[model samples]
Target: MIQTEIYNNGPVEVAYQVYDDFYHYKSGVYYHVYGDKPSGHAVKIIGWGTENKVDYWLVANSWSTTFGENGFFKIRRGTNECEIEENVVAGLPKSSGNIIGGFIAFLALIFYYMF
Candidate 1:
């Protein structure tokens, strides 16, 4: 069920995702009803399905992937997720051979959404 890959063997850096731009909202609920992102903020970039020469950068929503091609929404690109355009941060590290630590957290978050 997991399609995304996380590379953290090298230096840490923000995702230069295949898509462009990022979406941001003030605050909201995620999943069916489990993870309450009090942080109320996240950056989502639609995974331009494989095959397309140039992929599209769409915005992800709480809506299930069933809604769209894979539960994603198409929003304009070049949009800023928030004001302070802070430096990007690497995602889902997986180098130290001890990725389990991060994977566990990832699994917990996933279960929270599923349950």
Candidate 2:
């Protein structure tokens, strides 16, 4: 038998001073590691990565593709640069179109199986 354990912890409050500092952005990578001051804004962590032996996290931004890496950017991992790991939000898969349409499709599947 295989055993597994899960840990569920709440979000953490982090500080970010370089919220508008995009000049440091290059090739879709965000390397802002100076902002020690706190900001009221927030971001979400989508994934993680390792480049040149440096761990980092893949973050999504609201600025759209015009921003960095088609609206996505990478930050140094572990240290929680720009507070990317703190106050994080998990995104859900978007529905096809509308709730009614999804419901209708679900019902059709159920009916087809029953009849």
Candidate 3:
């Protein structure tokens, strides 16, 4: 299931974030499909940013809006802008070339546990 795929990335950082893929769609999420299995979607990539305004997430999508900025979703930061249902900040991808991301994540977990 999508949960397993999301969990595989471990507790620190996630490659994708699992969400109910039946309704909500936005930037940063990737859809998963398997033979005869119920598929779910996940938010791919973490620590990545866009040149757009910080209040919104510049997402690239496969929708018909491909001709222009419509191909993307300006997801509200610190908030959810859902077509039907709002999504939460599920997980984030570690930054590319992030040799120390794992270490930071580990330290974060330790710090969380200690607190």
- Please name the candidate that would achieve the greatest TM-score relative to the true structure: 2
Q: Which ten-residue region of model 1 has the weakest summed lDDT?
A: 12-21
- On residues 85-113, what C-alpha lDDT tens digit does candidate 3 reach at each position? 13222334556666576567656644543
Residue 56 in candidate 2, Cα distance off native in Å:
0.8
RMSD of each: 11.5, 13.9, 12.8
Q: Give candidate 3 regions above 4 Å deviation.
A: 1-54, 65-70, 83-115
Candidate 1: give the clashing pairs. Answer: 64-71, 65-70, 65-71
Model 2: per-residue lDDT, tens digit, 7-55? Answer: 1322222223355465346554566645443333444555566877877
Ranking by lDDT: 2, 3, 1
Q: Estimate the TM-score for candidate 3.
A: 0.26
Q: In model 2, where do residues sit more than 4 Å from their true spots?
A: 1-17, 33-38, 89-115
The residue-by-residue lDDT of candidate 1 on 1-115, one tens digit each, is 1113222232221222222122232222111223333332233443323223422334455555555445554422233223211223234535557677766755554454355
Index of the highest-lDDT prediction? 2
Q: Please provide TM-scores, in order, for all candidate models, with all chains considered together.
A: 0.28, 0.50, 0.26
Candidate 2, poorest ten consecutive residues by summed lDDT: 1-10
Q: Candidate 2 or 3, higher lDDT? A: 2
